[model samples]
Target: GIQVEQSPPDLILQEGANSTLRCNFSDSVNNLQWFHQNPWGQLINLFYIPSGTKQNGRLSATTVATERYSLLYISSSQTTDSGVYFCAVGGATGTYKYIFGTGTRLKVLA
Candidate 1:
């Protein structure tokens, strides 16, 4: 079985600030995804980066398998970005299912 851990269980950022969220995995993974759960309880997919770097507007992510960790970067944060960020991983050796971490709750003050 694989294990996932997320850092900074809670985060508070002012609008226009920047922040980085981290996720660590216990084993190698073949699939990974970043999601944002809004206050309304909707899970929105942010990225599906398995082993590289990717950026979407004000958001970006990087995964280093050798270090067994991943990072999510948010630049010029906005009120809309206030939510919970989650990291999910899936590997060949495990149950072949994605396991989601506890998540990093972010609150952006306007």
Candidate 2:
């Protein structure tokens, strides 16, 4: 079994601030993703960064599989971005499933 973790368990920011969140895993994995869980408890996949880096608008992510870690960055944060961010990892263990991190809670104030 693999263990996943998200740093800075909680975050509070102004509408325009910037932040970087991190995820650390204890074992090798075939897949890894970053997600945003909104107030309504909906999970939105942000990145499928099994490796390398990706950027979409003000959000970006990087996964270093060799190092067993990933990072999610947010620029000019917004209220819409206020939510719980999570890192989930999956492996080829005969079943398709994801082990999610505890999550990083972000609050973007107006």
Candidate 3:
């Protein structure tokens, strides 16, 4: 079993500001995914990087399996970015059981 935790439990930012969110896991995992829960409660898949860096638009993510941690970077954030970001990790057992991080709640002011 892997324990996942996210840093900066909460965040408030002005529009166009940049920020970083972190996710730490306690054990080794073969699957890792990042998701953004929009204000409307829809979950948007942001990344599926288990061990490398990836970028999509103004957002990017990096995962270092050796360090058991991952990072999400937001550049020039917008109000539309306000939401709860989650990191989910699944062990190598192929159990389809993924442990989700506590999540980082972000609010971008316009």
Candidate 4:
């Protein structure tokens, strides 16, 4: 079985600040995605990096499959970024089920 854990379960940041979120998995995963759950409860897909690194706007993510860990970087944070960030991964050996990290709750103060 594969397990997912997210660090800094809660975070508080001032506008324009930067933050890094982390996710650790117990096993290798072929499918990995980072998502941000907005204040309205909408899950926005931030990245789908099963390996390597990618960036989008003020956000970036890196997944080291060999290390069984992934990281999401948020730069120049904004109040709009206040929400819950999650990492979801699949392809856990013989199972097709996807597992989601506990989530990292972020609050950006303006």
Task: Please report how far candidate 1 places residue 72 from its true position, in Å.
Answer: 0.2
lDDT of 1 by residue, 1-110 (tens): 88999999999999999999999999999899999999999999999988889999999999998889999999999999999999999985756689999999999999
Candidate 1 total steric clashes: 0
Residue range 1-110, candidate 4, lDDT tens digits: 78999999999999999999999999989999999999999999999999999999999999999999999999999999999999999975778899999999999999
lDDT of 1: 0.95
Q: lDDT (CA) for every model shown?
A: 0.95, 0.94, 0.95, 0.95
In model 3, the runs with Cα more than 4 Å from the true position are none
Please report the TM-score between candidate 3 and the true structure: 0.97
RMSD to the native, candidate 3?
0.8
What are the per-model numbers of colliding residue pairs?
0, 0, 0, 0
In candidate 2, which residue pairs get closer than 3 Å at backbone N, Cα or C atoms, i.e. clash?
none
User: How does candidate 4 score on lDDT?
Assistant: 0.95
Clash pairs, model 1 backbone: none
Model 2, runs deviating above 4 Å: 92-95
